[model samples]
Target: MENKTNNYSYLRFAQEGKECIYDLFDAFLKKTIIEDRAIDFSKSMTVGDDGSIEFVTLEKDGAEVAFSELVGGDPSYKSVFELYLRRKACKAKDQLTARLALACAHLHWLWSLGMDCKTSCGMYGEAISVEEHWMDSLEDYNRESGLWHVNLSEAGVKQDLTLVFAIFHRFVTWPTRPQFKSVNQVKTALVEFVFKSKKNSGAPVRNGLLHLCDPDKYINWYSFESKTMFVTFHSEYLRGYKVSDYSELLAQDSLYYTRKYPKGMKLDPYQANRTEEKICYIFDRMEDNMPA
Candidate 1:
């Protein structure tokens, strides 16, 4: 933070091998002891053209919904899966609790990473509630003495996910082990939460790309046939943050939270480089896997 050297400490807790999208999916299939009263996730799920998940709901009419409907655009496998898991959680009572707990863990991640930055910018983003979603007091009601104009504030961009979690916790207290009644459930939820909560949109830079999972599927990047390499966050909100746009990234500590496992879980230069390589590889692979 103070060094202004782009320490990139956020990489310390990123998603890596065995924790990647594919790996996480495998684990979810193997684990997840909860009884799926709604949809049996054991059934193979496919990705939509827009990268949304083509999943079916077992509710009342058993209607179907795609990941794109809920998740913005060009959804990543990570975000796609998280959304799917959350939907499944809705089917059962226990999983719903676990998902909420995992949300709290995700909030902790946002808070912890910003603090790790230890920079003035980090402090600023952490302190300020970027998107404060609350009722406009005047919009509440009307009085005999005066007329009340009610206006519900929309959810604008927030600097950090911590702020979102703060408000959310107010209604559904932070997820706790005791409350969940199972450590395994909390642990699983934490994995999904951590995996999906990283800042995927910050790759070539920083901005609204926060809360992304894997950019390979979610993001769009330009390949250079003439000169230098260029990466871009394709989201309408994130594209605004240009390269080296420090202010916008005051809260976003890492391009993506891809971790180095079985090695003390430290965020270092090697891991940073590894993360870059993975992204590069994904884009490269896109050439072959991309639609015709």
Candidate 2:
């Protein structure tokens, strides 16, 4: 039994060492190719207004160079090589293998964009893990050690699966406030915000403002104005309107029904105020409608 255990350990160590060596060699070869092709990649050529390159003819079999074909390649290759380096540096035997895989995938995207893969820089943010509990539903795993272990009991696996679904649902439903100038821009921003926020927050929760509108839809502006006060609803939907249909109404005409309350409307035995009296009446009505 002792000899068998020692043989198994030796085999595992050999396999891991071989994988590490192959990865290192692959990284080294890519770096060499990029360095060798550095100079010819930096040449810039002028492009004409007709989207044509003056001296260069791009051939997909045979074609002319266009304005869009004028990018330098050296920086692009260098960026990709650096990305590989960053990914390799982040991987560790003690860390969750699934998380490391996710980090590697993120590095691929960063490499394509010439960006570096990096950890989040704020409180309560955790790096994404790709282990079976987070990646697959068939395994039980502990995150405390940062490594994913497989072959979990049926009950343990079920609990982990439930936790995963709950997290994903909460992430999808989180609200994103509008912070862009146009409604469409705001929608895209919200989608990105929700994705990042959900990844940061371990458990998914509904976003407070997720029901506002479809991100792809256009919104019209609406405003309400009285003589002394202007209350802009931006749109009827924002004001809790559910009818789904409304005709165009001019802002100036919409203010016609608003009564011209005095600017200094007050309530006292010495002063008479209709607006204050109406407001008080509305509050009393609201209080009366409250459930015990």
Candidate 3:
């Protein structure tokens, strides 16, 4: 059962984790606005001393209705908002389910090869490993231990799958968790746990698992360049970034890929390519294709 209000309440918060009037307005605007029409904020809006959007009035057809009144009277806005929330929740659920399936299969593949975490970590990028770089590891695991061939009979694999489920479950239910004030807080803890020590032997394993959970947010951490880029440039990306904003961007990206690519042509049939890598690849291609 999904709490539909999870995204609704989260959209109310600004980047600093404080609720913001503009953010709330933006949420409605995003869902309900017509592309061709623009609200003239100069006359139709009011700002408070605290920098909040104090009031709004929308004008159309030579008439004006108070935005607050429209919101109060219109059930359509509520319907649209709820619809959007359901779509977001559905996408999130799908992402989690597919990732969990892959994780279970990956763990089974490792166990079948008589590999513990230690052996898998040591054999990163090797032929007989599922702990390799992001792209190939997923391919290998999906090819070898797909749900059809996955073995849950092994006690060790079952134990590891339980732990994986717990970690992934924390993220799925994080919206209602009191300790995590926002997704950013949960993401911060994830970053610390996943990439805490670069030299740690389990770095590859940690990276692969986290990436499996959320490719849009988590980078493939085994590569040195990925770590360097994250350390150097991730903060710049975070400027003015809210958890809600991140979610919306993901929705946009997902939509773009869905419209542009056929199912089999996608980079990873299971999930989106890691966002960091895609951005860097775009930059490199732009440079290479430049007309000198």
lDDT of each: 0.28, 0.24, 0.32
Give a tens-digit lDDT track for model 3, residues 5-102.
12323221112211221222232233222121222222323433443332233345676532222222233433432243234132223533332333
The C-alpha local distance difference test score for the whole of candidate 1 amounts to 0.28
Give the CA lDDT, 0 to 100, for residue 229 in model 2. 26
Query: Tens digit of lDDT per residue, candidate 2, span 211-275?
Result: 11121121111111220121221222123322222232223223212233344653111111122
Off by over 4 Å in 2: 1-186, 189-204, 208-242, 245-292
Query: Which of candidates 1 and 2 reaches a greater lDDT?
Result: 1
Model 3 quality (TM-score): 0.22
Tens-digit lDDT track of model 1 for 1-292: 0112112223422222212222222222222212222222224334334332222232324554221122123324234334433442322135433333333232332232212121111222222222211111112111111111111142121323433332222212233423334424444443333323433421221111221223332222211110012222312223223334354333334532443323443223222323344444444555556789
RMSD of each: 21.9, 26.0, 22.8
Q: Which of 1 and 3 is ahead in TM-score?
A: 3
Please give the range of 10 consecutive residues that has the lowest summed lDDT in model 2. Answer: 215-224
Rank by lDDT, highest first: 3, 1, 2
TM-score of each: 0.19, 0.15, 0.22
